[model samples]
Target: MQIYDVCIIGAGPVGLSLAAALQKSKQLNKVLILDSIKKPKFNKQGLPNQRVLSVTQSSREVLQSVGAWDKLEQGRVNPYNRMIIDESNGQDYLEFKNQQAHIIEYDNIVNALLEVYDGEIEFESKLEKIELKPNEYVTVNDKFQCKLLIGSDGNKSKVKECSNIGTYGHSYHQMGIVCTVERTDQDSEVAYQTYLSNGCPLALLPLYNPYSSIVWTAYMDDYKYLMSLSDEEFLKVLNSQLGRYAPRIKSISNKRMAFPLQSLQAQRYIQKRIALIGDAAHSNHPMAGQGMNMGINDAALLANCIIKNSRSGNDIGLEQSLEEYESQAKLMNYTTSIAMELIKNTYENKTISPLRQLGAKIINNLDPIKQIMIQYGSKHPLGPSQFEWVK
Candidate 1:
């Protein structure tokens, strides 16, 4: 049987990134990554994928540490420096004029991470079984063994299931309709988000010139209705709802896709020799676009803990070392999850409309407060100041 120092399940951005980070440690070798699907392929000439991520500055640093940030195609990466926030009533609006985030396609991120990762990857290798032996390596699928098992799969993670980890979260009873749309205007450097009267938040995120991606969070019934509409009809409704806050939508440039929204957190980030990261560990609302950011932070933190333990000649899979990772990651994830929920509820509650409007006005006028908000939104508070392996 083959034995590895670490076995990571799921080869998405998070898993691939963790592999890249681990490779920085000279003492750690024999790392393996397994994914059930084929490796992701990026097409430069094809239309952008509907799924996208708002990569924050903190996440950019993590990618930079692994040498993956430079591998991203510059033309495809869109950076938005200005953000416009408003509501359907137009009673108030908040505008921020600082560097916020970058919009990148999901495939682009995975491809970049895969390129920089120097480790073994098993594509189409689904994990069937996991056996945990006390103070010993974990057996995967009865074929491979590893001292530490990391789950970066996703919300419906098989590793979490086999490890008997439970998750707690509630569905938002909403779906996010995502698509690429062509805009008539040329203001592609600004990102726009509007809270509609119906209690859904619609975001128009900039992409390459004349193209922007839209994430419209709608109630279940509204999502169904929107999906049922023809392209033209859907564009009409979208433009009407956006009003003057966003650019005029010319047409739908890509196929529309919808994903259910929910906030999920694993009861515990680690169990014996196993640890979870990414969506497997926690997930939050997309309103703040921090889901992937949090996951990347998780991978970075875990890599730090593992490397520190290995250098000290301590067992990397021991609960004591793993708890260091869990404490920091769980605190960040839980706090972000609660903040997102509060934002969602605050905007949706009709009785608090007046107060919400007043608060928006107040926030807009207070430059100091707005600056603080922008800094927090653009960076993760718990992210490492400097990666130990980067030096």
Candidate 2:
């Protein structure tokens, strides 16, 4: 059996990004990536997919370092230089006057990373089992052996379960519904989000000309009613609810999708030779738009940790050596998740609505507080530094 240096399960953006980042490591050799899903296929002239991500500037730097940012540019990339957050009562508001984030389709991101990645990737390889020996290595299906194993398989991580890692989190009563529509006005450059009286926050994310992606977070009953509406009826309600913000929904570009919201975190990120990253380690509420960013940051930190361990001539798979990666990532992710939960609870709970309004008002007037948030959301403090990649 050829024991590889590292084996990563799942070929999603997180996994692919890790692979690309590790390719720059001088000491690492022989990486194996496995995933059941085949590579995505996108026509040159198709509309952007409904599953889009709010990519932070920090994330763009990571992709740029790996020679993937230019790939995204070939597709539809909408740069929203500002964000306008307002409440239902229209009393308090917050705005950020910087190119903080961009809206990119999930498929475009995955495809871009896949283009610059160079490694042994085995597609249609569903992970059935993982066995990790305390002082030895990890075996996948008794065939592929690796000194270190990584799980980027998302919320239902097979590697996490096989390693006996426990997770704890409760499901929010809300469901997230997403779709893309064309607005009457195509000149808006800012991302707009409004908190409704019923606690549902509707977001209009800028896309290409006259189009914006909508993410409406609401209770299941509301979700069901919206889902049940006909095309025209849905447009009527959406236009009415968003009023002038959305103008009129000329048409629904794609099929709508919904999923339950929850915050799940694994008890431990590392066990012997195996470590979990991305959604496998933690899942957060979409209200913050930090789920993908956190996962990408995890990959970067873990890669740096591996590089440092290699330089010290230490076992990269040793749980002790990998402790720093886990500690830093868990701390950052936990803090962000908790903050997002508090925000969700504050507005979602009717009793605390006034308090939320008051807090927003206070935050609006406080420039320092607003700057802190913009700094955190726009770029991560400890992310990988900007680098010029050889194109």
Candidate 3:
């Protein structure tokens, strides 16, 4: 009987993140990461690296904790010192800056973490089944048992299914359409977004000085129409309405992508001794692009808690600890989901008033709100103390 201290059952950002996080754990030296894919080429071969993860300060600390931050590429990573969220009407806008928030290349961060943590990342090991033994040990793939099992698999986590954990939340009547565009005229390291009042998409996030990632969260039917447009026409339509604010049009670089915009959180992020992280536990609407960052935070928190418990000689990933993780995961995931809902409702619901938009405008202009938004959105803009996990 060969048992591991910890086993992660996913190779996405969340799973890799956990391996990265638990790499140097004194409590978990023997860890195995299993993924079903023979290789992580599922999206890599097609997607133009369409993702541009917005790394918060806490996320940076998380990467650093896992020995991956310094490995981030020098030039490929673009920093957004400032961001502006404006309405198509140009009347309402929210602005944040480096003193406000920051971001980085999505793939760069993931690959950096992988490069640093040269450990067991079994890409092709698809989890066919998982059974919790009478001893409460999770036996996965009929091969391994662990003191702990982490389902960082993703939104449709097989771990969650096998464990029979109930879920909550709704599939938003929206789809997040993502793409990359080249900027004709450039300015400071900044991002721009134009929120629509009548059920259109939300904002665009900056990827590079000359490029940005478009996260158009809109109705599926509407997005499908846009998707059918020729590349030039798509850029034209994107520019026609959102273009007036743009210096140049965009062309899909990464596999032109679109997925249903839904917010889902597992009813219990943990079951028995197994803990769920990232999309397995929570999938918030990406109106904010905070999903990856949030999962990174979860990895950091779980790692810290386990390490702390080990230092104090407590059971790592025990029932009590897993409960705490679930509680906190629910809170964080729910709070973020609601925030995204607020913005979504404001734009999607036709009954929303211009006064409501004004209220958003007023809120955005406030220094305290601005600071909190920047801090929260950027994951510890205030400093390390506020976000204790970063410490």
Candidate 4:
């Protein structure tokens, strides 16, 4: 048995982040990474279709710690200075503004994070097996007999599965069709969104000059038609629903792709010494585009947990600590998922329900409400609700 202090499963963002975080610990070492894909095998299918991550302040700090934040070009990732969220029932909108809310291309951030990794990566190495002894010592693929294990692969994480941890959610029946489109309006650096009676609202997130990232969520059946539409027809459909909110529409280019939306949470984030982080533990709807940012935050929390507890002369893989991490993560993930889904549901009503309209008016009219959201979304601007651990 190859005994070690820790072993990481999955080489995606969460996995890589965990591995990198562990490598940074002078108190810890003997970390090994095993993933199903080949090393450097990033999901490059969305090359043309840019991904925009709405990162919070805290998450941004985590990325910088791992050197991922510095790899991005200043112009590649644009800030979300303004946001327009509308109700389905009425023409009213809840708009928010912040000088600091930023957006980064998905692949750019991932590749950047991967660039700083300078350790063992056993890619194309699937989790063919996972054995957790009663002592909480885990053996993965009959290779790792380590004291700690982390599941950061993804929603369908094999580490979570092999451990027999139960899942507690289902699919949202919505798919996010993301793409890049050229914009004509030069002054449109702000983000814009519009609610449609046609179901599933469309969001136009500003990117660098002349391009905006479109995360169009629609029903299962409607997704095909939206994707199949030719550039001209697609632009027409988008113009009709989003023209008012979108900048001057020009050519829609880039790889357009769709991903099923889901709201999932593991029944327990820890089983023995193995801990789950990022999407493996909880997967939220992307309506808010905080998925990766949340994952980054998870990385930060666990990294701190390991560092704090290990220094206290306690086993970093204690059940109590893992449970605490889970409880904290579950609350935040569930809350964000529900909020995004609720906001999505409320956007399709033709009447813009009175209460919803009031919310729009309240948020739009009140700077505090808008700032609160910016703080919540950016995980910054410091508020009373901000957890002490994050600061």
Q: How accurate is candidate 3 locally (lDDT)?
A: 0.70
lDDT of 1 by residue, 1-391 (tens): 9999999999988888889999976668799999999878899898877888889999998998889999998789999999888899766888888765899998999999988886899999998899999589999999999999999999889999999999998888899999999998998789999999977889999999888999999999899999999999999999999846678899998778999888889999998889999999987889988898999989999999899999899889888889989999998888778888888888889898888989999888899998888787777686666676775
Candidate that would win on TM-score:
1
Alpha-carbon TM-score of each model against the true structure: 0.98, 0.94, 0.89, 0.89
RMSD of candidates 1 onward, in order: 1.1, 2.3, 3.1, 3.3
Q: How well is each residue in 1-391 modelled by candidate 2, as lDDT tens digits?
A: 8789899999888988888888765468789899988767655487767888899877887888777889875548888887777766556676667756889888889888888887899888899997777788888988889999999999999999999999989777788899988887776578877778787788888888888888888788899999999878888887777723435567888888897888899999998898899999998888768888889888888888887887789998998888988998888888778888877777678876667767777887887888888888767675544331222
Error of 4 at 111 (Å): 1.6
- The collision pairs in model 3 are 35-125, 36-126, 37-124, 47-255, 48-254, 48-255, 81-98, 97-100, 239-243
lDDT by candidate, in order shown: 0.89, 0.82, 0.70, 0.73
Q: Candidate 4's error at 61, in angstroms?
A: 1.2
Please report, as a residue range, the 10-residue window in candidate 2 with the lowest summed lDDT: 382-391
The local distance difference test score of model 2 is 0.82
lDDT, residue 117, candidate 2: 84
Ranking by lDDT: 1, 2, 4, 3
Q: List the residue pairs that clash in candidate 2.
A: none
Per-residue lDDT, model 4, residue 231, is 82
